[model samples]
Target: MFKKLLLVVFIAAISCTKNDGFQPNGDVLSIIPLEKCENGFAGEYPCNDYDLLDYISLEEIGGIGTKGNDCWGWTDPLDNKEYALMGTNKGITFIDITNPTEVVILGTLATRTVNSSWRDVKVHNTVAYVVSEAADHGMQIFNLEKLRNVTNPPVVFESDYDYTGFGSAHNIVINKTKDYVYPVGTTRSGTYKGGPLFINIEDPANPIDEGGFINYSHDAQVVTYNGPDTEHQGKEILIGSNEVEVVIVDITDKSNPIKLSAISYSNVEYTHQGWFTEDFKYFILGDELDELRKGLNTRTIVFDFTDLDNPVHHFDYSGSSAAVDHNGYVKGNTYYLANYTAGVRMLDISNIENKTITEVGYFDTYPDNDMAAFNGVWNVYPYFPSGNIIVSDINSGFFVIRKSGS
Candidate 1:
């Protein structure tokens, strides 16, 4: 989330329909044949050991502006079919990726308000919640099961529930372990000062507003604390990337949530987003602006959380490119990173505790130069049961990818 107030203002000034002279190629629905990573290249896309399952362009998905920000995956509890929820400037797109070769564009749900270049979506118990930076764009909750009843393909879908309790959120966090959803980076000057909103979504349609943290958070990952920290093992822990520092809080009791601790790293530009290892002993963080501001190759910091109250920076892993790291998620021992200009990179964190991380594979959706700019894959969804990867790009629209020979 490179969403500082200055850039948000500049983007909201423009219009989604206003053409900036960028035209897409794939206007009709079509499927791309599987291209395996051979001799360092998959079709025209550069890669190591990752293969391109399929690709859908912005024009094909009826995208007006070349702006996509976040992505999430939803697996139907009814049939275990995997679906990709891609957040665009105008709305959130739903695609049926059960069959990577024959991908289906379910449709798009228009934003709660006008377009503003940033949208985030997350899934919890058959419901998908979406948020955007557009003014008055409240959290949109859509029924995931409805995807099975679209009579016409690619229609302009609508949300099942619209919660306007708060306006314009940057990202949505859900700890499925409990019946609550956290919306962080909301409208500033609110009671919580743009911190995480603790809303009880026990009834997906009727989300009740509970109390929340009172600090601005760019992005965060909240867990039920089943990690190594036995002191607060069962508490609701939220690790927020709050601009300059990472803040940890105990939200098990929303009425009086406690701040466990906060830590900052060196050469910090902007503390963007982070994910905990499988063990939760280590946290992997990304600095969104360090590559461009500090001229550093895609930097990723690893923090030792053996002591949650006093976290320490263990080491930093530099990617092969100078592109910015947008969003990353850990699926088992592999770290799936959405490198802004370099596309999606997979890192082997099996030995991360020993300060040893390796680049396992990559699939470059942006074939252009890997610069430290924000014009490539925005997010990646790798938690699907089918082992497929769903990637959302700013210039391109949708993509389905997977590791070679997987």
Candidate 2:
């Protein structure tokens, strides 16, 4: 009887080991290629593995500051060279990514105030605009063209313009068409309290505070959509990822913005960030804490934004891995998702109207199974024309990748 009991316990232990989700031998901090699995997809394309193209070690660039959160890629209109502007606790690090194989570290501009964990960057014309949530850390402006003249590697420089008014900001987005900058999450007290701070950056180096709305916006994407509402035609609409709901606001008049409506869906656990479809019909939202709290993969809530006042939840697509969803962007029919440890996932949303998303390819930067943590890919930029995808990893650093065959 004792031998039988021991045998049963051993078998149970083996079963548990087989079902374990942790990848102990995996490269938790290294990029690896993704293998093709027919769990759902019909066709098998050449999906390249998440190869570690290059790792920008903190020692090589600069030690991590208070926080290194977001990044933006700037392209020189004259030379047509692409540069990466990374947001750190200290400030922003500019790198020339013209050569994916060899990422050149241009330099970094320290924070205007004390360093914080969160910082965001955006580019307009030829200038880069940065914002951080550090105390007294207002917005800083730098001319990106100056980077072209850097003869030595890692050339350090100071900010040319410091736009003061808001002390701290979580994220900043620029509206090139209107020359306006939207700074979301301004206060450091807590979530759902910081409103979006709007500033006009028509004069690259010099920014003017136009005004902002206190709608408690955490992150947002602004665009002038021609679909749906006729009354809002050609008007700039701000889609904010509020704490509990997606707030749609008409910010055409920055001084006095009107709240269009607020939309929410089931299993909503922190309405963090979202992006709109190219046709302005659907809005993809990312729940920051759903994976940890809900015991499921990161849930991406898709909503029909056809009616500005009445947004409907169309469908929810959850990845196979358990990685949490962070920031995502839509280009044409593809939804580029920064799936924490899962790396960057490219979803084919050609049939978004039917609420169908096919995972065509994925670059698993974090070899470990997706878990609820901020130690993996934080953000991805896939609009780099050259098919080279750039992922900013929290633990492993930055990676530059191209499509498999490309």
Best by TM-score: 1
Note the residue pairs that clash in candidate 2.
Answer: 32-50, 33-49, 33-50, 34-49, 67-89, 67-117
What would you estimate as the lDDT of candidate 1?
0.86
In model 1, the Cα lDDT at residue 7 comes to 13
The per-model lDDT (C-alpha) reads 0.86, 0.74
Query: How well is each residue in 279-298 modelled by candidate 2, as lDDT tens digits?
Result: 88899999998887888876
Give the distance in Å from residue 79's predicted Cα in candidate 1 to where it truly belongs.
Answer: 0.9
lDDT of 1 by residue, 264-367 (tens): 99999999999999888999999999999999999999999988999999999998989999999998999999998899999999999899999988989899
Task: Compute each candidate's TM-score over C-alphas.
Answer: 0.91, 0.85
